[model samples]
Target: MRSKIYNAPCERESVRLLRFAAATAALSALAVLAPATASALPAEKKPSPSVVDVHDSELTDKQIRDFWTPERVKEALRNPAKAPATRAARSRTATSPSPSPDLAASAPARGFAADAARSGANTAAGLSVSQEVPAGAGNNIVGKLIYVSPTGELTHCSAASIVSANKNTIWTAGHCVHEGDGSGEAGWSKYVMYYPGYSRGADPVGEWTAARLHAPTAWTQDGDAYEADIAAVVLNPRLDGNLEDVVGYAFGYLFTENRTDYAGAAVMGYPAEGYQRSDLDGERLMYCAGDTTDAFPLNPFDDRIKLDCDMGRGVSGGAFVWGPQNDPRIVGAASHVALDDAGQRVSDDLFSSEHGSYAAALINTVNNEG
Candidate 1:
């Protein structure tokens, strides 16, 4: 396997490791959401996803921990940079066109900010109140992800743990792991790491590094295909056991055959905006709860399941859950923030590609491999 180096960032003042007492105190004030429900269309009988083994970060566990120090994490959280790596460069060739200005526009507006406020759901776009996950219910299901883009910039996104045979697979958006546009260093991300139960600056469940990645060919080939914008990653087990075992839980996925509507659903992510977030800095998991609707012709590139939640940029790979709260199934991931007619992202109008046979096959292949 080809390996990529995590280009180190400029050094800064060192921050101390997390304290258990502080974490416990913070957890006391966090509020968890109820069970998830959603409407969905049945999955089409398509062939398995054309899986592509993408880039490998190749960093050791200690290196990952050391690289993402509290200082760096604080910087990322306080002022999270938008998608800088994916901005297609301005090409000079006659046939090659310059990267569209819209591609580099700010993240879409938070999904359902207005409707949510009117309905008494939190205005920042999730659940009925503060977006923090309950103390223990979301320990393993959601976490903060850090990675180096192809051009070598440090950035973060949200990701989730999934039930896999190897017991070490994670699910996230395709753009989170690879340069979906197929440009950049080796066309893949480097030094990718996931920190479950990462609150404030503490990693309660330890860090999981990416050993291998699997993405749909459609994304790797061009990056514009939203329907095929999901990815699965196999992680190196830490301390002699897998991540799910360490955190005590993992989530399942769903692939219905016909389109369906949900009465209610929960969308969980690590967002840096839409709340009193100076403390958490994208460290604690937050959620938006509401019904889902179809927004088929909005983007033209993919048929998205429109939700009235206010999730924004940093939560790109967070899970959209349907079913019982304690044991919900993931039907899709927070893909791209849907863009409005003026080319700005619509935050309250969150969108996710319908997970189907292709996603199932991709996850199965990654877990079964080796």
Candidate 2:
């Protein structure tokens, strides 16, 4: 569970994003109570996992290969000018002063091959899991693992993967972004950033400045972080020139809305949680296999994609795609699921069309937005 609005300063603004939004709700709005929707999924007789629709007759089901990946998702960014309005949510991090940007420099080819190779190898050799993280990420109130404030405080700041052109880019679960004092606000901590492949205090791996941030507008304007539960971020100048190139952007889904055959799907992220994003138990590489249901009220609880992938507070805004690096076609993101019910926490798989846009429309946004 994550503390909503650890960052209190932006509480007022974040309230605007909430559902029954009021003037100054504390973490109550953004803070997630365990099982946001009290619908205990209740343990039922064991059943075989359902298969998702992988091949579409309308569109050729391209053989997802080893080259597909979350890093390469940025290829869609080619349409920088046409990206979606979703990018606007990032305004908080981008407009802030002092967090400062490096005078734009032509991207260098330094360490591209060496770094990408290392990242690939590391991922291939990383832990493996039998379960998957839930489908969403955000500020939960119960069982919180960490806490971060709008003032750059980091008792529990959510982590994101940086993938900016300057290499100053990162992705985090959405809760870390909108929970200004737990009101699901848009403003984030000023000095906030991420520690990639973060291990204990060592902060030994890569570090980048939070020059820009982007999450779905739902999270920023409507406090509906649960809906778009994904985010993109830009790094500081350090990414301009680095040893390891850092990871690339996550690819968009092959479809605009939801697709299926995702039972064996894979996802990866530096979930600041003690458990690995993959583990069926806590703390292991998480794997996913479940069904998505319709969206409901209370806790937005409905038939979204369901999964038993164990996740903690930090895994929000992470990517849930087809085989991750191997088959980078993004299928869904981590939405919340209720565990006490026994179905385990089921994750919803949101697609480009779920928001009623075509694949290219989303591509257009990624390419055009500033």
Candidate 3:
């Protein structure tokens, strides 16, 4: 059945304030929005993801960590990185696209939280709109991903820790890690670091460096296919422990889920621009909650999920989640914010490729190999 798309109102102050306060103390402390049932479906076989070793050269993990001094991070924040863009369309009434026939009947949806719990879990144009997540108000799992782009530009994007066997996995957009298609070794980023629970210049859980980066071959070889824009990083263990352990929790994964399943979901990130609030500068976590639809006329065949969010640059790779508020599961990562003919972002639209076999395989490859 097709799900109806509904515009979520600007988050209410009372609700926003409560989440802000709780997110600051501990996101896990929040209650689950609903209970989830374990899926009885069998896992599907899919190809592994392409992996890149960030420490393959003389660059040791410590050096990579030291590379990002407070001064450098602040500088990177000043230049919020732009996500790869797509030609914008004017219609908002397009119908949802169908999942690929081969993947349509694949495994039932499944999720795994920080402690290994299961759970179930859009868009517009014009500078892209987003609500600022209060500084230090506590969703530490979601934070800024800072890296030196292939072009030597220090930039940032939103990323989150996810439940994994090594306890060191974080999810983000493929473009955040690689240059796309034929750009190759020169395209891979350097000195990738994640700051969970980051507030205005505060590193509540400290910094973690990436050991390896993984992206679907579809993304590395085929350019910016929305479905393949997802990417994962295997992080080196911090002095304290795994990332999730140090951060207190990690979001669960929701794979092979249908777009209609996300009737209500929350997308969180550190958006750098497009909002009127001066306080938002890509250092604070921001969020938008609403119903999602298919990418429709934008790319009718890919079946990307759509929402009415105006979050701009630096928000790419942000987490799109649904389920219990305390134990939310990630369904997809932010990929593209549609751009109009004049090269401006559509005011209220965002898109994420639907997570299916490819997504499951990407995460599995990183967990087992990276």
Candidate 4:
């Protein structure tokens, strides 16, 4: 199978698109663990699945925090063309089995009302396909994640703080944290930092650096499998407290959910391109809400869901949320854009791996080991 996979990341001028054949590999079975709850789980007692792979940034928190100066961040925003490109190996063709019914779980968000007070209204031009997240809507949980790629390019992707036992874990796409397991390309990102409530370079909630990054072996070891494109980051605490405490909210999780559960769901991020809108420069929060459809039914090995969204690069790793606007649960992270046979992006479609047992296992590993 041939496909053009563009994992979104924003930098200086052009979007990084990877093209490769598809490889057939079965999804690995994850060790069962109890579902997470709103309360923190016991760190020493919980057992996580072995399928999760952890990558330590290996830099001092200060080193990571001090690298992103105002000027450097401005450069990252201005260039828009220097983003690192990963030449992933052939895509994996694998069937991801459904998780046990008992694995379905969720946790509530915290600190939203307080953070909304600090958020400002969206100021970018609107597109017919997506609208700016309303001001003071408590969507501060979603933000931008900036990091230096192994190739030394400064880039950014959308991410969100999630309710976790440690209260410091955030969710994003696997490609946001590690280049795919392609020859001469597999590696972790560097100087990872997250800016919650980021708008046009404004850091309303301050910045948090990653203490550790986690992705499934299927993404880091096997070919860059779309079904395992989810990742998590454990953040170092700020001077005041954890990320969710400072941002005033973290999105809840909805694991083991299917495409049917995402009707009227919202996919949000900072998109630098899409809908042919010149005003979209990855500076503000945008969202497209609608029903979703199976992206690959004939393959059976790929269970990603696609939304009728026009969000493009920089939206990768953003949250796909369900439920009421006031209280949303994250079902998946933005993974990639489907491309036509001509090798151009299918602008109307955004894809995400359905969150299931692998996601739960990854989160549990981060909570216990990170």
lDDT of 2 by residue, 85-128 (tens): 13212244432111111111111111112112112222222122
lDDT of 3 at 298: 42
TM-scores for all candidates: the values are 0.69, 0.45, 0.75, 0.78
Most lDDT-accurate candidate: 4
Worst lDDT window (10 residues) for model 1?
3-12
What's the best-to-worst order under TM-score? 4, 3, 1, 2
Which sections of candidate 3 miss by over 4 Å? 1-58, 84-129, 134-138, 257-261, 275-279, 297-300
lDDT of 1 by residue, 1-370 (tens): 1101111000001111211111111122122323233222223232333444445656776776678777776655554324423321112321222121111100111111111111222223224232666666445557877877676677887777776667687888777777666553476777778887777777776788888877765556554333445688788888758876665555666643222234456667777654223443466677766655554544333344545555565777777665433334566677655444554443455666545444555565564464
Residue runs of model 4 more than 4 Å from their true location after superposition: 1-3, 8-49, 78-105, 111-128, 182-186, 257-261
| Model 1 steric clash total | 34
Residue 253 CA error for candidate 1 (Å)? 0.7
Any runs in candidate 1 off by more than 4 Å, and if so which? Answer: 1-50, 78-130, 256-260, 275-281, 297-302, 340-343
Residue 42 lDDT, candidate 3, scale 0-100: 36
lDDT of 3: 0.59
Taken over the whole model, the C-alpha lDDT of each candidate is: 0.53, 0.28, 0.59, 0.62
Model 2 alpha-carbon miss at residue 126, Å:
17
**Model 4, range 108-167, lDDT digits (tens) per residue?**
544422122111112221222766775542555778888877667788888988888777
How far does residue 328 in candidate 1 sit from its true spot (Å)?
A: 1.0
Which candidate gets the maximum TM-score versus the true structure? Answer: 4
